[model samples]
Target chain A: MSTKDNPSESGRRNFFKLAAAGSLGALMASTPLKKVLAQVQDPEKPATNIADALKIPKTETSMPGKFPGKVVKVFDAQSVVEDKPVKTAAYQMLSDAMLQLTGAATLSEAWLMFVQPHEKIGLKLNPIGGKLLSSSHEVVQSVIEQLLEAGIPKENIVLWDRREFQLHEAGFTADAYPGIAITGTEKKDADGSYYNKEGKLYSEEMIDKDWFYFADVDGEYDDYTLPYMVNAGKYSYFTKILTQDLDKIINIPILKNAGSSITLCLKNLGYGVITNTGRLHAKLWGDTSAEVCCFPPVRDKVVLNVVDGLRGCYQGGPGANPQYICNYNTLLVGTDAVAVDRIGYDIVLKKRIEEGIQQEDSPRGRQFMEYAAQLGLGEADIEKIDLVEVIK
Target chain B: MKNTLILFLFLFAGNCFAQQPFVLRDDVLPDITSVNTRLFDKDGLWGYINGGADLYLEYGFEQVTVFDIKAGGIDYKADVYRMASPEAAFGIFSISRFKCQESARITPDDCLTPYQYIAAKGNFYFSISNSSGSPEAQVHLLAIAGNLLEQIENLSIEKPSLFNYEMLGPHLSGLKYISGQLGMQNGFVRWEPLFQQSKNYTAWIMPVKQDGSIFYVALVDFSDSADMETFMQKNGLTASNGLNQVVGNKIYTLFIKQNNRLVLTEGVIPESLRDYLEKF
Candidate 1:
């Protein structure tokens, strides 16, 4: 009953396409040819090893899962009280959004549509913003409660991110969620050291060597950055948690902006589950964000995207800048990562315009969403999306 | 005074070599809970900011010193970025400032929001933030900023002569300085497509609001004539056309090209700006 086993007929066709694409590509490794390849490449758009990730086929449980081109936004004025996210309000917001998204009569029914009692669920969080604008604990609690109501055991759930300490700094701890496994790809030892006795980063052990996203550009990290990036080279490996530890993924990204673009569903899951991402951001951010999810480990597992928009930054974001922080007091839920991101982008864009951050819409901001759509991930066109809004 | 200025320049240069500019002395603010500082060089910037470091690097970064201060029961984080030039520092500051509540009393190029204060002076961009935007926290934040600015004084940046006019004094807060695509995307997004074709340029934009209508005046300094020529060709601008005004559905644009610079106005252009457009 493993979710990975069964594939639809269309999935099989994609599998053959992937096998065909990887035949000659898998043989080409990091070599002197890389220098020659770099010379002819677009200096602006650097060549990435995205073909390597697409070698594996998408599965039945792939992105835009049960429902595609559908997004449900639940808003409540009382979601935050005295700057703190109210847990009860969050629970109700999520409950209503999921029911509307799935058209389910009960909360458990809506939860069961995306998960089962047997599957291991992973909640990927964005904690880069720290306490000011990180993914709220109230939303996470509401999600966990719904999963439990659907009969999934607490031990079957795990909380994870790229950095372990950052998750703790954002207030995700064992004491907070008892029996639930809390982990990250990059970890520090009990004595506050990034390296173990062997002088190798603990992050290196968490990566799956078999799975990697190969970009033509090389990343050179200094001693200070090495701990954060884990490795420096042409390869960015996928974390084992996505490859083996989790059977299903529920992406929980804070509703935030990265310049003109929104860092919603794909940006979180794309950048969160991979190592050596510090290099990809400069030239290949939009491409890596779309291509990384094409890999089977992520594409086939991410079933849901829950955006915590209760408190988010409208201007200087993807990182926390307190001046731009606003109380959105809304939760956006969708099975389609791209569609969810599109809606989230609109929300942030409207806020930015209202704040007079920018004069009008910037096409550059929507490039990532368009790229994600071109890759057949989900819907990016605003007109095609079926948005269901629930006001409480 | 000249000798003191020379000594200050020498100290500033020496400070770069020494790597520690000025440490926050505990004695200065006795009521402060704690002050922690960390330095990020070119190689280690990604460690602190992750992907957000790319835009800063694109604008030309040297290093940044971050300070974490807990005072008056509020947590504050301040970052002082040393950029390649005054323009680069101002470019970063212009894009980062949101709906500024009021101008900071320190420098003309400064914004003070409820939770953040951003300013640019010389080759340094300073950003200070607090978790709680209480009046007490803001007072402590300003004290810290004032102290930090006092340590490095008499450093100023050269600006375009157009900014010196008294007409723009009230609208100075709406000004934006941009150098690259990242800055364009963040600050002046409406002009992103027009600037996207050009390789190297610096632009300063000022927005004026009158009678509930907002319009913009922008001056772009192109690095080379070839880039300017290409820009003119792409946007249908020619010297022969003289004052070219294109009317769109929502806005009216006036394009004026001079040598390697372009002065443009959008929306309801003010008569003063239109009169000044002839001089360019």
Candidate 2:
């Protein structure tokens, strides 16, 4: 190994000593930030001076971020519970979130700023985890009330997810609540295939053939051509529900750790919207899942993220393992999915670590976050994220 | 020692589903209301628990005996991971550390909390958590946990005798034991790479606090002396005289060999504190 490969203990001590002395700002400002950044980033390059070692590269986050400092708003009300008929706590939480997210003087104004009368809005509800740990009905009710107050007609609003069976199993049905269109692309039948009871195939008219983005992995499932793009054939086709069906989406994802680390806004869309996700996870924690959000269907379409932290799963989740679940009773909201997911990832990771689970990093979801950032989707770095915590 | 009940369950003649070889007894806690379990093997475990289930399975976890204990209108969740062997039980147990400032001795070779508990017994590594927390709740949990432990007949690995508590100092909360790496990016204010490498080889770590200051004292035993020397040289600390060689910036490191074990320690403590060590 080269002499530059191994830095001495004095070198490390000097770095800490500089930290203690609070010369970090002077050191960071002394040199051209980018040039000094390159040397410190290099594994093989040994530290020549304490200043060079001290330099940290400021993350070049995506500009014109929707939320200030790429922040996600997290609101928790200890009062939000399952037994209550009307969620008195959820209304407070939602109102506080809207007032902060849009910086409106009132909750109605915040909702109005986002929802115009012309656009048909979709409230994407994730009910996959079912009764124990899915999006709370009371939380959704708060969203509906806000949208109505904002001047959007009841007919213009729709609450939907992947399959109607899951939606129904999650306690959402069109007939159960009149005047609100609660629907799905297809109904999951007894055999677990997507089909409408009326005998229409879900893949037929529902999936927009022209608007799909393809990953084009090894074997050809469908007879489509010229389907290769971005990051070496990490191909996928976007859901028409996220693309053509709705003009905008208000994401309601449950907080849980997927087998691949975290299943927040990114995974909710990446896996929930795509047709062929099995091919992606086969890579064993790579950037494939991250690249899915880079597509416009999720990246541009999602206007709000309200993570259902009311009851969260630290382990054995995105499934109903009630043993690993806990009640956080908080809702995390932000415009940027990357920022929102990063915070959600930390919450779950901390719980896992406390439970004595060893993880190298949030390796699977983390890289995908960086890929999203690399594509100018949103800010993935934690330092740049401005977290807004609201206690209701 | 593995949980003997696991093999004992297989020997019985009854409805195979009714009695799992390894499960907590129903009447362990006086106030126990109900019980629930989540287990992982080759197939069902994949959709179970958090990210590190694979690590436990690799450490010989045949099943994770998760118990949901309901008592006094409060619920506590306990997980008894029955590893294939006692060695596997301890290896996986390395991932957990005492989260408090100092662990109150409620059980031998264990850490306790009314809200949470971690202990390694035979081939079973047990963890208990209750969102319902209080001194009374903790007392109930300990009683429930203690009795539950008594019911399990399994082989276990003792806490390493190598750790010299007096010399290591009293900041027991700062101590950690893991056969796995600490996820440092060169993590936590850029001490990542150093902690990442130094932690996995660690048998024990203690934060020696004095004069309102804390110095991290650690004992890492490497399998090979040559590798230990390489590790010392690579970190730019080549010990010149007994344990004082890597000293710098209020940080002290000692590299020693006791037989095949390469016991290394680095911290922000005085070098004279090395006199406190006693071999396993």
Candidate 3:
């Protein structure tokens, strides 16, 4: 058969041509026409087929020089009452399994590595999803208790979200833990000043001056605007308080189906740093989303990524309507934000398939996962990932 | 022949429809309650008087009209002359800084600075002068009466102008008028005059405080839009969609109908007038 009719012969010729060239740089330069020829020849390793004799670089791990290992720990357990499988028992089992993965003898050792003893750890939770599809209270309180037991002072721990009123509506109270506190950026002190004003809580200030400084002087929203920054002058983007005191941040986000693809660690950080986050929604576009996500303030600041997947929201989430919540009984943790979100995209896809939903119909099912992967954020291929599961 | 006539008539009607109305209202001065009420309080120093003695006249001829004035409290002054023509009334006011000790002294160069020109005819005080360096100042103009020394304090400056007019009707209160210099970028003064209709012409006036100083006020009739547009263009103003609607092709004229009134007073231009002139 002619080489055109025999696909295997064409593949062999392309492979030898690439091999004889010795390097991808030489091959691409020598036979520019072979660029299209390389794509169809290797189906399994297409990204590698374009280049030859070059090994793909290993993914970067949290600890430098160490290969990235499985960061998630899952456990299997039976329910006490229903005599059926209980997810909460699985959570407790996974908590133990996490200690083994990290090579720590106890939970305290694991937490010590999770949060340093001297650090004032801010546990940023997502309550925007309301109670059902939010960061579980049990998981949050468990992490808070773990930090306290690991020698981080109770006063050094604060459970924070964007709005205090919403946190209260979602069932967190000031009086719940006296030493260990739960507060939002909007909390007021005894003197009635905002807790986060003038670089107090977060370092970066809100952009639009009219919302805070001008609105206060005009006495527009007298109750909310005046008492907070009444005498305080205008603050610029450089005047945020959280940047000063925070040495590290623990991002506890819920894995949810978002309108802008998977809302996980990246979206959680988007809401955390800026004051006028609604501006993001008003000017939404594909490049705008990536630009805002990769803005300097967010890209460098987030150090830990802990996604709560015990009860996932797999459809039309990041907004709490009753239809999206699913009991996946998984808790995922990784220092690589992109990796954690990559796994989140997979969970969303699997859940959609189980419900007989088309991938194209799901907003979170798009190729942004591969785009984010190509941007060096994480690995999209399941085969390249080392997933670890445990049972009790 | 009937069809041709109908077509000609139709074209003429369409041409007439394309012409827009002149003298459109632009931005309204914010209705600050206290300032508005004080401007109209007839029972107070700002009110109109029927007739009065040379009642507290410090200088000039006898027949004086008493009007109460208040900045924070009550004061009194006489109404000198209400101008018969709208074109001659004008006034200027501004807040700025004095750069040197010679800054307040009137020289040809003094007119180059916005602050010095305003100070030449009015009391200028350094609100934050270092004396060691150039200091910022806030200046106010007092209406000049015949006697330079007897002009009431800055508080009673508006008294003389307010009492001279009689109201024709309540709707006349909304007829807004302004006066300022025509061509000088750094040498313009602005004022709003109150007017009530009379039998022959629209009677309007601006107050002058003659406390040994001279200031300029001008009046222009806002009725002719073409005159206003010409004046704005000569003064280096270009047509703005906003000012074009407010003053373009509208017929207005200026006149001086008061005595001891500050000279160099030009017609009042709209605040939006600068935007039109600035394009040139």
Candidate 4:
């Protein structure tokens, strides 16, 4: 339903009035008020025309579907090596495939178009998997190299995640690659509070001497109340900083069969956008991971998605639970995040079936692609999408 | 048999008569005099004063009485100031006797207990006692008081904890709820970042639901009308027409769809005495 028809607005107004009155009877009556507010603020929005939103041109092969875009599958290779030579071969093959899919003249040009040079690019890397199941070093380096070749200066490109110490543990050097700089948000601010220099900080204008302003709305409604809105002194602000400065974002998600579900581009963006990533699970509405994935802050900022499938964990993931890593030697790149994730879902299903695992039995096997598609994020159907491969 | 019955009846009657005649005593209670002072007192308390002694009382609740000696022809007014409750119970009264004179200097320290006096300094503090005096119970009470007491009440205590002092101000303001979204840009001061090229565009609407209300806030990054029109057409979402005004570098469009109804009210308070309601 559209936000205009939301029942929570009046309910919230009532709640505020009752709260201001300090009346117990009013508070008791406001129970439904709270529920209605939660429902209206359910995070999910209609992803209608996402392909058009990303400026994906209409093609003859594009079929009419319930969702906004289509998912295309390219190549699925098993038993690939992780060393430099093997990784280069895999990337070259993947890059060629992406070039063909995008209809660009060269791989570099396609990469440039996908990630515009003038815009400040935030490459959100999924590093929670540590060294073993994180975004492959080869994939990250290749993208960086491609951006550098496309004339995107090193300073404008920021390789970021939540923690810098974790990146160091995973063997990433502290070198500033001329044009591209790498850092995390755990550094100290001048005011003694921690600062996330690259991402969106809590607006300083909202902070009073003791109390801080936290709005679920755009700060326009008079029904505003400060319930969970903590006083600034009472709580330390831990902000997701990278989102603030960047004009555009390229999400590099490792293809892993998450214990919770598929950890694809949507999960990557959703988790990366919020300071408290763990709180998503605590939300009462079922499948908080999927719900939070649809938030405008993360969903709107994402310009492109590139899924690393060269070596994937098909069984357990989002941090190696072991018995899940499988070499799939694939790279799925697309502007449509939902479509890219849908294809990733198919790859996971294929691996699960090959290993004699029941797709319905696994948590990661749950059909989020369908739900995401219903939300207008992308197309789950393969018949409408045109897939082209260039392998050397 | 008749004699025995008569004797039984008499015993019963005598028992009933003994239960009678319980009367509330009507003796003249101590006349409590009101003084313009900042002390707390109730009934059943008296203050003693000596002649030619200096005394001062700030205003709240204080009592004064005069004692005269006929032989010496000397009259003196004894000032009694009601101190705060020793055990921290509300409405329980205590008093301190002060000798009255023409002019006297009184500080908060003289009227309040050392801990209470320091707490009155508008700072947050907690008391830690090393002695073997009900440590667990006292610690709990101190913690409760730390959370509950206002800044004015805290001025009476001495040596309040620094951490508690820092926490007090913010804790009182409470949490604020806000709702809004990011949507279409109407204009730009400079072509930078998201607006790199002449027609670069991006915008979003976050119709935030807060405190049982909905507020529509739009964040837009493009100034081109054509781009905005295309965006509106592509998304199947309508734009708030005529909201093209730009303030500074950012453009803001605000429209309130609903008002919050939750009102805070003191149910039992009398309307005439609303000014003193915060004190409660």
Which candidate comes out best when scored by DockQ?
1
Q: Write model 3 residue lDDT over B1-280, tens digit each, in one string.
A: 1111111111011112332211101111111112111111112211111011011110112111222122222121213221111121111121111122334233111111211222212221111100111112112112211121122122112222322224212212122223321111111112211121101121123322234432222333443454444544544444432232223423232322233121122234333333322221
Interface root-mean-square deviation, each candidate = 1.4, 11.1, 31.6, 33.3
True contacts kept of each: 0.83, 0.00, 0.00, 0.00
Docking quality category of candidate 4 according to DockQ thresholds: incorrect
Indicate the worst ten consecutive residues by lDDT in candidate 4 chain B.
Answer: B180-189
lDDT tens string, model 2, B1-280?
1222132332111112234354455555556666655554533343343223445544446666566667777777777676666555655444343344225354444666445666666666777766555667677667656865775554445445544456553444444444433222101212333433453243454445587765555556666766566666667776543344443443555646575344444444554555544232
Model with the higher DockQ, candidate 2 or 3: 2
lDDT string, candidate 1, B1-280, tens digits: 1111111121232124333347455544435676667788888898888888888988988888888877666788888888888888888987887677778578877888778888887778889888888777777667767766666654566667776566666787777888888877777778787777777888899888877888777888888888878876787655532253563444445454666777766676666766666564
Local accuracy of candidate 4 as per-residue lDDT tens digits, B64-86? 21211111121111122222221
What DockQ values do the models have? 0.61, 0.04, 0.01, 0.01
Worst 10-residue stretch by lDDT in candidate 2 chain A? A223-232
- In candidate 3, stretches whose alpha carbon ends up further than 4 angstroms from where it belongs are A1-69, A73-94, A187-241, A282-301, A359-368, B1-280
What number of clashing residue pairs does each candidate have, in the order they appear?
1, 16, 58, 90
Select the stronger candidate by lDDT from 2 and 3.
2
Q: Tell me candidate 2's interface RMSD.
A: 11.1
Q: Please report how far candidate 1 places residue A359 from its true position, in Å.
A: 3.1
lDDT by residue (A319-388, candidate 2, tens digit) is 5544467766677877777788888888887777676443345463477676555544567789888788
Q: Chain B alone, TM-score of each model?
A: 0.85, 0.68, 0.18, 0.15
